[model samples]
Target: MNSKIQNDIKELVEEQVISKEIAASIENYYKSKKGDTPNRLFTVFAVLGSTLVGLGIILILAHNWDSFSRSIKTVFAFTPLIIGQLIVGYTIIKKKNITWREASGVFLFFAVGSSIALVSQIYNIPGNFSSYMLTWVLLCAPLIYLLKSNALAILHIVFVTSYACSFGYFNGNNTPWMYLVLLAVMMPYYYQLLKNKKIHNITSIFNWLIPLSAVIVLGTFVKKSEELGFLMYVILFGLLYNIGKIPFFDNQKLRRNGYLILGSLGTIYMLLLTSFEWLWKDILRHEIIINSQEFYVSVVLLLVTLGVLIFSYSKKRIQNFNLFQYVFVMFTIIFFLGVSGSIISIILINLLTLILGVMAIKIGADKFHFGILNYGLLIITALIVCRFFDTNMSFVLRGLLFVSVGVGFFLTNYMMLKKQKGKIE
Candidate 1:
């Protein structure tokens, strides 16, 4: 009797015949609810709105160009900038709800500033481009603080960096001090972005841009001599090493990608430096231009060396001594030894490459599959074989050297790969 009553209850429930209204209520109760959809439409509208406003401003400027006197045009250029400052000031004071109007106003300010600078140049105004750029950046800097405007702040930073790279780099006026100043200027805004945790995308953009700019500007001053260039690489890699030591759990993507990009590029650059004979040849053949005092170079080198030592000691991690850092320090010490002019440095360099290449392959094989270190080893092996088998050598000897190096490379790499597979299995 109990089984029969239970079966009947199951049949009734499965039929869903507890009246149409109750059945509908039960279905609704179990149905999953969805939250609001993403606002892609707003994003599209914002992009379109900015484009139209930019075009409208350009059109107005074009139409007025012929009729307006030079002074009037100049006044017109600054008028937008002045208005932008007022709008930003008002936004700061009121702390009102953000609206499209305020955003558009800030965007216009950027457009107006750029237009003024560009138009002034087009008319061949007798003003310096650097000075104008400096002024514009200074004016925009306060907007970042006063209105808490990330967009304006980033725009200013990018413009300043671009200007510095163009003028300072090409003109041979770039200095470490200049890079330090630019970094300083951007630091406060960087701090604010971190504190608020807003505008993360913008913050990421500046983080990459600022460091890259520093590298480019600093590189110009660094390439004065082979020794100095080697010193610069040491500093560059030291910076990379410090960056890699950051706690990865906080931002794995940023930390890993940053190290990879900077380290890879720095390594390739140092490799090219190692391979080229021009740097050493130039130093040996000609008197080095000593426009600056030796103290300058010594000071820069000391600071970079101290930075590396401090970080290495503080971290106490073996991995901190990466390929770039090791090569940089080795090159610096070798160059300072006054033996770079000898033919022996070439042999020594090649030998170093072979050893490091083998070590890299061995270490990488332990961590990753596919013998990832084979590429570096292959490059070094090729260089050694080519150097030993040049036309200056007898044919039989050249053939033997090539075969020996080639066989060694194949055997070592194959063993590494085989060991990796065994571990994985």
Candidate 2:
């Protein structure tokens, strides 16, 4: 058991709420539970070792590749693929070991890539990096189910996203619709992993990769209307933030909660950037259309976001009034105000930031959470820094503002800590 639980149990015993024997039994059960869990080191090394072996084999073959005949090179290319397939197939049919499954899946994954790369090099095949990644990821995707491997699933997500970036952003492809198809193909396996609760470290991988893929691929869906893109992002962030609020992901680590982190950061950053007059001026120059593909996408996302919001509201899942929980409403108002040429939008944006900072401080103080308190202070400091960049602000005034905010930070933190200490005593 962790220290907190151990202390609680000890207190229970002292209060005569439970006997010492019961506390000892609970501790022994936790000890046995810890012993029963698998060592993650083996799983880590399995993936690492298989990857290195695959790379080493490729390097060794490459060294003598120039001397080999076409037939020999072809044989060499297919050998790893054949061997990997056999290993994976055998692991699927007979092996129940997670380490074995992961090691074999990873080995086979690289083997397929190497085999394809070597064959392409030998035959002088013409293909882009995006197509290559797409092919590799699709081929490896089945291993997630066949081997039941979360490690391979993580790798698959990384490559699939890399393919989207390569195809859409780097290649500037006009028809990037294939990315959506491929992304959809991978979702079933992700859901399977979620259903089985097999994810551990892989959860962090998903948290980072999914948001990154969305950021990369969402641009591909934009056709003519760029302004609608902002609306799309607002809905997107709202959806992500709500997903993170779901019960399964609610209590995970900060990094593991990518939806909340990315959504909140994206919303705040977009709001801050939009607070400037030039952005609104540019938007006013365009003929705002309500019938574009971007518009449809935005509307669809908005509806989904609203659905989640309503569901969350009904469930009382959003007890805390964090910035992420309410930025969608704030952004919608700000957008309308900006379009109408009202200075009130900018004022509202600034006010929203200040309110968020103050709320964070209040919540942090109530919970005795130093991170939340610092985050609130950081938001205020960020606003001050943003103000310093404006040509309209005098250097002297900016300096005074910074000094004043700095003093507030110090005093507020000092007072909170004093209060917390007093409570402890």
lDDT of 1 by residue, 69-113 (tens): 877777766665666556555655677433433364455556666
Per-model tally of clashing residue pairs: 0, 0
Candidate 2 structure quality by residue, lDDT tens digits, 1-425 = 58998999989999999999999999999989988776689888988999999999999999999999999999999999999889888887886588889999999999999988998999999998988887888788778888878788778767876777677678863546677776777688777656665346665677778776786678777768877677677778778888878766777766677777787677667766765667767763356577888878877887788888888889888776666676776677677666677778777887887787788778778878887788778878887787677658888888899899889889988998999899999
Give me the displacement of residue 82 in model 1, in angstroms.
Answer: 4.5
**Whole-model lDDT per candidate:** 0.57, 0.79
Which regions of candidate 2 fall more than 4 Å away from where they truly are? 1-36, 192-201, 253-255, 283-285, 320-323, 340-343
Top-lDDT candidate index: 2
Q: Give RMSD (Å) of candidate 2 vs. truth.
A: 3.8
Q: How accurate is candidate 1 locally (lDDT)?
A: 0.57
For model 1, the stretches where C-alpha displacement exceeds 4 angstroms are 1-52, 70-75, 86-109, 115-125, 147-150, 172-177, 191-204, 222-227, 248-251, 254-256, 283-298, 315-323, 338-340, 369-425
Cα distance off (Å), candidate 1, residue 345: 3.2
TM-scores for every predicted model: 0.68, 0.86
Please give the lDDT score for candidate 2.
0.79
